[model samples]
Target: MSAALDQTGSAGHWSPVESWSRDELESYQLERLREQLGRLARSPGHYGDLFGRMGFEPEEIRELSDITALPFTHKADYVASVAAAPPHGRFVSVPMSEVRRIHFSSGTTAKPTPQFWTQRDLDRWADLYARTAHAQGVEPGDVFQCLFTYTWFVGGLGATLGYQRAGATCIPAGSQDTARQISTIFEYGTTVLCGTPSFIVHLGEEIEKRGLSPATSKVRAIMVGGEPGASVPATRKRIQDLWDARCYDFYGCLEFQPIAGECEAQSGPHIAEDFVCAEIVDPDTKAPVPDGTPGVLVVTHLDKQAGPLVRWWTGDIVVRDRSRCGCGRTHARLVGGVHGRADDMLIVRGVNVFPSAVEDVVRAIPGLGDEYQIVVDRSVRDDATGFLKGIRLRVEGSDPALPARLAEAIKQRLSIRAEIELLPPGSLERTTHKAKRLVRADD
Candidate 1:
């Protein structure tokens, strides 16, 4: 059966729920939230203990707003629970027998947080991914080459199943040799390329070195996530120019398999309202903020059966728009993708700076390479305040005049002067997975 037929069986969306009104979606969410809370309350695990300590009951959750009364679940909490419990941790709601798979976080900042998925959880994950894929225009006969790693990371396996479920042929080409991967793109007539934006940019450069034009390749769409590049205007334009295809953002993390995704309209990623109830709260106060306000994102699984997360603090900074999208999705849209991770924010001379903001400035300049790094040199600390003395930007660009232009651009955009250092192309290290942008010189 064709993907279109399957998606349209019940309604115009992949599932009938995607087109639901705000009231319908909220009503469904309330029902599922109660069930999830009830399950967590009944489980002899961490959540039950937490609820008992707070004198909170599942029945007390009369409405979604009441969820605010519960304490937020942080990554540290899961790590601590894993340390206390042996295998799956005390946060899991289901038995080990029902768990069909285990995936871990990238562990870039901390140890990999173990995630368990039962058969039902895996099915829901794939179904939600299928919905996202369909919305992003994945269909039968489209060959999707997944460049995400397949080891323990959730991105690779989830994307493979989701695209396949959307009726696309998937090649699980985990991040390995870029040359071989590029060869496979042509060999298999791959119609879609999936991976981090950095890898795609690197692939495009490699294609140029091989005397081939990426724009002329069979790939018609580039589905990117796991980092913040595709949503940035200059970065998005670069990828689109390199591949001559539409660049769609697939936003999710290990904790949430398929949170939100961009439709064909490409306005922004629409949250999976029926799958997860998303909340944006002040990072400091932890109070829910109004829609369209930038704050830390908190996610709760609505129907997850295994390790269900209730108010999992994502720590990702984003703005939520609850208005209907041009594509008719009533689900909230994450404006401009994730602004930046709350922890990733840098304080430079009393000015708040996000690497993405610098990236926007650097990538906008002509003749600059795709790779760049931000350095926080602790050696140059202020004697009086004991704070950062200066910031430096290391970039790959041959033009001597590039540094001056970049410095001015950074100062104008960020309101802080940045020491710009220009290096020859290929000086900076490249990666196939998530790219690290910030580095402390002291480390």
Candidate 2:
């Protein structure tokens, strides 16, 4: 049995709110929302003006559903607000003195969304992340190596603080030195490996190149976040087989850091209901979808102190299931982790292809290297629709017949023909930071 699961049956519970019923959770949320709205009402920021314009009295939210009546917050709005005001802008609810941490989105496309966190907010984040590590079975005396970047407006610092709070020794080795990261794992007996699924794969490839046996390694778990991979069946299975560890998926965004994640049961990632009120809604209409249906995840911060967002659209697609988990938590669990970002979907030949879905196919193939890139060329071949879209999947593989097989798998899974180009090992670039998936040939 897994060390975390065995401990979960006895001493693995995180907080009292985890056992609360929906009624109790909702009631608690309403009270907190009242408090949150009242704070925003008196604050000097975009949120205050937003609430005032809605004439939304804190006490007026008699039920949780009343939140829908308010305007939904989007990333574009934050970018514009911050661009006009600079730095945090009116989006910051707390004064400059109260804010201690500043985080920003990847800024890959548009302007980065700046996130402000007060000292108290950091503590709460630590608490939530502690629960995340504990959920995956990290206990006292265990060591966790954090391979994510540690500087700037990134998510790595939170995991570092979180594991320390959870009573585990944290090794802050941001993806720079692969050799050192591997040596630290065995030297420190690191029990938990926290990083993106792509980097984990890179580490596995590095291990094999060094002629080392991971079965003899001390690492026991892998907590994946920052990009989709942990829940991708093929991706997760590959990581599991490589390190022989329990892999857990974490779900959250720059606006809301580490809100939901998986437990030892590994059913799915459970959202912190006491802190975040989550809803899965249609990506287009923004209307609520029935449980177990995939939709854009809209979230509201119930306990955030710096910039408590309400009805913020997270762009990531997920399904919420309230089924009781064997781990004894009633918090809502994302059915299949995050499938893909609505914005990241690639339309090829009138067919939608998610990068993660493509990853599922790529990772399942044996002897395929850890790196892969998807490029969609609009100028390739066009029919009557004016878009003869072609998807080129560049993967690191030496097998001559691998391209044909991969093309067939991509065709079968995504229902679209892809031109697969297999390269020798290490042909594709690797990343210590966020792995770039789509390389647009149109540029």
Candidate 3:
């Protein structure tokens, strides 16, 4: 009944999918792609209509490269399809009666979008979650504390199933209630902590407020996702110091909950190449870029039942390294761990800036707290031209010199000057779930 045995199944232990040669892996991918295609064609969904409109026949895909023939599935396309078809949309691959769960995106930019999952889809999601946990060194005896939101978000489901797959006990510590979170760690001897990087940092601050250090907790490792912080050296070290635990980074999207994860080496997160195919391409030209080149992240789901995504363009900017990692997983790793987003780009005084870039600077400063917001102020606007007033940073802290120091650091790193305003230590609101990084302030 050990985790290793559980993963091995009765046949053997551990799946060697990552260890397969390039050709072998591609062959498997092609098989999965074909199976998904046939299912899509048979189902009454938008994908089948899309494939037909493009004159693409599933039989025509003789090789993996032939996937390029299919048209890309854009999120806007899904939004439109939902408006036209209603509810789950025609893109759903299963019968409407089979869907057991429905999750909504936070959708800061627009209204929340609906995603449906059948029992089969949930099962696959659990398997992927578990695979990541085991790959990241989650052991049989470890106790995992799940602190993500389970109300409408998909993250909690991923952590719960992953712990179950790894044969570890999971404490369902839902988001909110910081005091309860701190008590559970010591009371239950939680060995694994999983949540957003900001929340983890806030948890550390709360623990310290009670005259306790991170070292006093039994938790040994922290898995961070839903935001970019663990990849940044300063933030990673801060959280590690908070609880004296190892930090691991995970990358996933609302479209696909589990994409890649960092192994013990902590170099970068390895892509789930088996289930998903990732490509870095120019955000504007949509052309494939070199492995290490920074570009927009484009994902294609090779396996999925409820929502079959084909060449879905994710708006995030990133870099990938396919070189073999020291951890021995042959899957590609994400470099810089989601540097920024194409949509979140800010034009501040003729300089292009990202919220994450500002974050890198803020989290590195000593006196700053977790709750912070960036504002791109616009003095005047017209149809022809606009004036760049400046970018203002409102951080949670009361230190007298912290604002000047933070502004100087940002100017040095981004080559763009920023105005910092320090608020009371607990003046700004803290997020129990996702951290909001930017707010527009125009005057």
Candidate 4:
């Protein structure tokens, strides 16, 4: 069968769940989930041991509600397992010969985790990506220009395949040269742009410097991922105003190829529960949080074959809403997108500050654009006298007064004064995708 047909088959049918009734889609997910657990339990090694330790067979989880009994798989478990078994770990359901593609994790916290995909897994991931593209208003004949990095990472590849499978022309721009990327957008008359939020902002700045109007360009929509800023209202508004195009937020990782994506409604992103089951749990207790509460995100891939992930902890914080969404999808929705990562928290003088919090304040400042970084350093004084330790804000902008205003705003909002330094135009390095914002000078 062709890739499209294979994907449709894997999804059990292509009828848009967005149109289906809540109860109907719930039934469908429960039915498919039972089958997934059965297939996973039959696999050997770690999964077998896991099922045995749980004291119940996969068949016991026939209903979706029964999932509560299954033990959540944390990232630490996977890290330790991969360390014990080098390269590809024993979590893989299939042999090495069957795997076709490999994508490495971001490794922002530690060593990069490798995820392998079979042809079938790729097809399923592509289908979900296509659903996301379609929901974002991408048409069959539209031309897509991908600006995301494709090097050993799945973001660009998955997007390219998705546009292809959606019957659209895809240009593999591959996150190189900003000048060339802007030139290509005009030359090809591309309608869709995909990349990290920072790269899109950088491209917009370059476009402005070159006397190019994004509104005049053929771009109509920008699909952004690989970072949390895409969903921030202030950041999203800035990018939309710069490009004059609709900005859609997409969230995913190497472990789970298609986690969630925004629809044209531009509300919260719909979790692709058909392929991956998502759960929000208390960071310390490993217990599920109530709807509309913030907690860490945990995921399990339903159709992943090469390296099947079951209840894998993402370590990212999110707010999950079980209530029915306006988009009509029965799947859960992640409100406000990813809040921040648990590991990214900085505790200074008893107050915990997340980069996202700083981002909210920085991006909301009227004069400052979305280009800024937060630097954290330990105090040199032997005795801790003051409440403030060492938090500095490095802002990149041409305007002189923008940095000071941003500093005042941060102080008012955070109740902690931050030393703000305004850098010369283009002083801070710009990344092609997923800009690194936080730097720990203490280490």
Candidate 5:
């Protein structure tokens, strides 16, 4: 057994594994990785076929770096597998009788990907979330209001169970009804608010609009994820200023439950090294990159069952740091959280642009509102071949000089020229869940 798992830790930590040395963490990870891969080899599923095709054996994995040799499981692969076998695909390791719950991806691309979780899988997810919440300072007295979607999306129920495990009074006030949510916060004395960065900012705006101050509220910690805003410096500052709370960024997807989170240091979110082996790789090349280099994040579940995934490509851009955090945790940190998805990155005039980058620039401007959208329209040519003409940033602001100021800022920061459209405040749609930052004009 791992020493961290065997021994308990201080009140500030949920587990002793958080402070394990690099070698100790990797040793534990290797043992778990080999066990999971061995199960994959013995099982009759997509992984077996993938291993056979690659002529790779689980026993050949002698060190952690050997994980790079394993095949990456992409979203397209999962979709195709599901098409071949409906409902839970061949990727599900256990039988249907064992599956206790089924969650799904947000399905922003095509159809929703089903995630199979047995009771053990579910318990592990909740425990991982509990560890993250504990790191964010959730105690028995804290009342947590989860604002992430509660349906097929895994964010809500997983977080709700986790905070409850951490001894907090949890309210499953999922994403809806901004006014009622604010009232619930005051009535319940909710000390912890969990939602995407966009909704929290929206809630803060609504509070101020009602001739109230969100700073005076009892909320001390705001845990935000399911989007990129919480890691953006300007957006983080905006949220902290509005709520007078310590804003923490969590990085996880439906496929992988709550896997990483920020501690009290607030520098970056520490990856749960014992639960998952996180790799930063070049998006196109799929080769491991050095620490501090921006790359697509690939994760492998170390202690998952029912549907264990190997080298699941997340596509979210991020930088990793291996240095021990000031909070005294030895787990590697995702330095700026998720920096948009590789698929969502837009290339304009020989420059790559991400919506979060635009947001970072926009939010830093003095008079801009919290809501903004990046509109993509085409330029029709004589031959009927449509090309990406340009990007138009639609922002809500009443300041007459805002357009020129924002355009200049974008040019300076992103090295690309984009048309700026300033609308009156409240013109853009407010979201209670993940904010839609990019949209095609034709759509």
Candidate 6:
């Protein structure tokens, strides 16, 4: 067993309850809430506007639970606010000169959303990430190969800084040139490999194509993010089987950095209550959902000084389990990490199919990576009136023959025939940031 697995086995039995009592955790969250609100009140423009709109003084929010009374901030509001004010947007707390770095959202739906970070904000972000890495068994002297993109997106830089803070030597190999990444993994004796679930599978395939067995590779732990592959049983199993490494899942967003993360036990992602306040609510009524019930995830950043967000509505869906996790952390746990985005759900012929569901089925097929895309287009021929035409899926595959086989399997599983297209191996561009898997041609 690898060092990470050994640590996981040893620490797996410890529950989050052992780390802190419920009262103690609540106290800590309340303290952080005061500090964050004070910082927001002192800032100029946007925060003041929000506070005025809420018709309450920042001081009125004494306890952490009082945060629920505040109105939720949606992505559309932030985008509009930013458009009205260029560059940093009204959310920026510090002056432009004080800002050290800028990170933008992957913007899978529309234009990318930009987030500014001061040196202090960066330090806090890194510290939280380091805590997560250490809890997951990444140790000092361990070499980490960061496979996420290092462009405007925050995943690459945030992870690299966090790993470095944890005393790991990170190989800044952003997602590109799989051959070179595999070569570096061997050369540097990297112990931890970090990337999206799909990219990791692609790297594994490249390693096999180059006559490399990932089981014999120096990598010991694989950390995945940017998607829900870690929570999916078949997809997670495939990645672990391919890399011969302990796979840990982390769930976060551009609006709120590092909301919840996995430890060695891999039971679920533990929410970082010290830094974030999470609310699982029914997407339709905006009412709190019972524990274990899947709902829309809303977040509030507690320690962010540069661009502190309050009750930010993240379009992701997840189930929150307040019961203690297997890991020794008092924070709430996301039972299966992020299930899927609210917008990604498709109702096909009285059956609901999420892109993630399709992805799970596709990834389960042997010899296929997570590089496929679902193309939905309107049927060119007019159908009979009163019956709406359903969605079509054009799955991208590396091998020319795999699409037909995959279509057959999907038909058997989903009980619907989906048009599958087999493009060239590199036909679909590999992205280092968020993988754009679902494309609506009719839109």
lDDT of each: 0.87, 0.83, 0.80, 0.79, 0.87, 0.77
Model 6 score (lDDT):
0.77
**Candidate 2 lowest-lDDT run of ten:** 1-10
lDDT of 2 by residue, 1-443 (tens): 23344344344577666767777888998889878878888898887787788777777778888888888888888888988998767778877899998888878778777788999899889888988887777778988899988767567898899888877888888878899988888887888888888899888878888999775788888898888888888988988888998888987778898779899888889998888888889988889999988899988989799988888988998878997788888899997788888877777767866788888999888878878998866645575675646678889877898998888888888898888878888888888777888776765
CA shift at 354, candidate 6, in angstroms? 2.0
In the range 239-278, model 3's lDDT, one tens digit per residue, is 8887889998888988887888887789888888888877
Q: Give the local distance difference test score of model 4.
A: 0.79
Clashes of each: 0, 2, 4, 0, 0, 1
- Tell me the lDDT of model 2 at 237: 91
**What clash count does candidate 5 reach?**
0
Winning model by lDDT: 5
- Which structure is stronger by TM-score: 1 or 6? 1
State every prediction's TM-score relative to the real structure.
Answer: 0.96, 0.93, 0.92, 0.90, 0.94, 0.86
* For every candidate, C-alpha RMSD to the true structure in Å: 1.8, 3.3, 2.9, 3.4, 2.7, 4.5
Q: Identify the leading candidate in terms of TM-score.
A: 1
How many pairs in model 1 have backbone atoms within 3 A of each other, for residues 3 or more apart or on separate chains, i.e. clashes?
Answer: 0
Compute the lDDT of residue 183 as modeled in candidate 4.
85
lDDT of 5 by residue, 265-311 (tens): 99899998998999999998888899998899999988788888999
Tens-place lDDT per residue, model 1, 182-206, is 8999888999988999999999999
Sorting all predicted structures by TM-score, with the top scorer first, yields 1, 5, 2, 3, 4, 6
Clashing pairs in 3: 8-13, 45-90, 46-90, 214-243
* lDDT at position 58, candidate 2: 79
